[model samples]
Target: MELKLYRAGWALALPAVRMLLARRGRGAGMRFLEERLGRDWQARAPGALWFHCASVGEVMTACPLVRRLHARGAAPLLVTTNTPTGARTATRVLPGAVGHAYLPVDTRRRVARFLDRFRPRALLVCETEIWPELYGACHRRGIPVVLFNARLTERTLRAPAWLARLYAQALAPVRGVLARSEGDAERFRALGAHRVQVVGNLKWAGCPADPAGPPPSAVPYWAAVSTHEDEELRLARIERMLPSDAPVLALVPRHPERGPAIAARLRAAGFGVAVRSRGEPPAERIWLVDTLGEALRFMAHAELVFMGGSLVPAGGHNLLEPARLGRAVVVGPHMEDFAQETEDLVEAGAVVQVDDEGEAGRTIARLLADAAARRALGQAAAAFVAARGETVLEAYLAELHAARLPLDRAPA
Candidate 1:
């Protein structure tokens, strides 16, 4: 079987994998190992719980559960993130209470070592992180795994039949699944999960704490948040079309490392650009919010926001941040992931949908020009977020509580 082969492959490659991981540092593979073996790691309280969040979004979604776990005396909430950014965000959010680590490569030995050392009470898997060796190791140790805020898009369900079966095999050890939506629950059932509950999307409640201090600057601004490479250039084009009297434009690149290159491109196209961390706030044109974690701060001040990833192939970044902050919202045509939420907002006249760069530019320009329209949209956006958020978060907490009860006393 594919699953057996995968386990065997990891077992066979353990030595080389260990060697490779040992040298990889905190950027990726061995980061998890380093943190696991770090000073405080061994000092963790007994019977602590482990929660795996795949990346930034998953980590954001898991915060509520992590908070609840810690409140219930689940000391040493072991949190692992696959991305460096996610690790940074976790540390920022969880502070002194949670342990941050990189997730090891899903090799059998590494997973076994990780589980044996930590011996978590229960494993809460956020979103769709279905690691075969990891789950298998957990099963062997009688640890229950729960998938919280679970979802399966149409694209996932449309994968090859063998791949679907492989997915089911990977998740077989999971005790319960808390799906983000009814559609997600149906997909899990089709893929052969035993128990799936249709909890609403967890993102509805995922707002980071408000940033301390005033807006970064006094300049009236509008933000283009989580903008991708393709979307960034398109945004520059949009900026050119705006009236000079319009508010300052803040462009936050999704990847901070890409900031310089994007700034260069935007400058070449004749826009005045100020990279947030470096330059003084320009009296004239765009504010390039090229720093990490500051986009949310900038979003809190913007008059209108264009959420990115939707502009291109990436499904979309979380839009709730901008909406919850009561900013008028605009997004592109490709938000397959947040399509339901986006549609709901658009129908309520809270969010503006645009087909491409031209439309995006015009929509933003119009929103800026009409103060009344901006105010009405902002109110609508905030209301939409408030109405749906608590319902989703409470349901997810209930599911997490249910999943944790059975695994709390397993002989580890």
Candidate 2:
């Protein structure tokens, strides 16, 4: 009953949704709909393995799993993403994929058409994308579906009964749900997922090898990464609190387009700033990394790293990235999105936790002043990450093998 109502509502809402997507400048998703409506999907390769990633972070988290699938002879991979940035990253990182496309809209007819055209043997969804129509279409076609690196927050679990029922129905068709943590696994079970398992976060599987390039700067530096609005001003003030001989600071905003404004603000605060997009390096006191896909590079040269989005109300970006890079890490108190992971890290002495910007400054200053302490923190962080086994990927592979899916190697 809930499923029928949801389908009816979704059908009625699709035209408005399309208009909203166009208004929001999601040209790639719009183009995909146009092509599908024109029956252009008939021209693409069929019966490939399909993976769907929602955005940039999902793309990064799915990268290692995609590579493993490809390495295991999963030929003719197809990657579908909801956002242009995700599509671009999929194309750039998973060149082995036969093609990339925007995920078809969630209407039953459109999703059915996509399933028929692609004829994928299995569908792998990253994170929390629970589309009822899409899952139903796959189920009707007898295609297996799996959710990897799955997470369900408190907000989702506590949704009203009707909406919760809709989610339960949507998740019913999924063959397996490999959750990022035990908490997530319980939530999936609560939503009526049948074959849920607690698999550690796939983000811990590993990041892509650093590209071959010189360090962004020779000077010792500290990096503030994936920062959100107003975080730059707060971080710059924190930089002032550091001792005169502290390492240079690198500010990498979550949205690179904010670079010019961030640089201007930092300059107004009496600090020398250089914007990376403008070909500026760490020559100044603060180097604003106004680019994408280079956070790891900047992190490599940092004495310590501050994971952003936490100081404010944002749920915090990935702390594991810097931890994997063996950098001493600090984060503010608002890590609700990563509550379990952050708590575990703090308990293990793998990270420094601060309540506010002022505490962040003082904590960073103290860590910077003690080289031995910084090194110890970095070591603990790296070790902590290493201890979380990559058995999730292995378990996924075993499941695939038991199911006897096609994984013939693709041509090099």
lDDT, candidate 1, 1-26, per-residue tens:
77776667767886786566465444
Q: What would the TM-scores of all predictions be?
A: 0.85, 0.85
Which regions of candidate 1 fall more than 4 Å away from where they truly are? 8-40, 72-76, 83-85, 99-102, 153-164, 207-212, 277-280, 401-412
Best by lDDT: 2
* Clashing pairs for predicted structure model 1, backbone only: none
Residue ranges of candidate 2 with Cα displaced over 4 Å: 1-5, 19-38, 42-44, 95-98, 158-161, 209-212, 259-284, 347-349, 355-358, 383-389, 399-412
Q: lDDT of candidate 2?
A: 0.80
- lDDT of each candidate versus the true structure: 0.77, 0.80
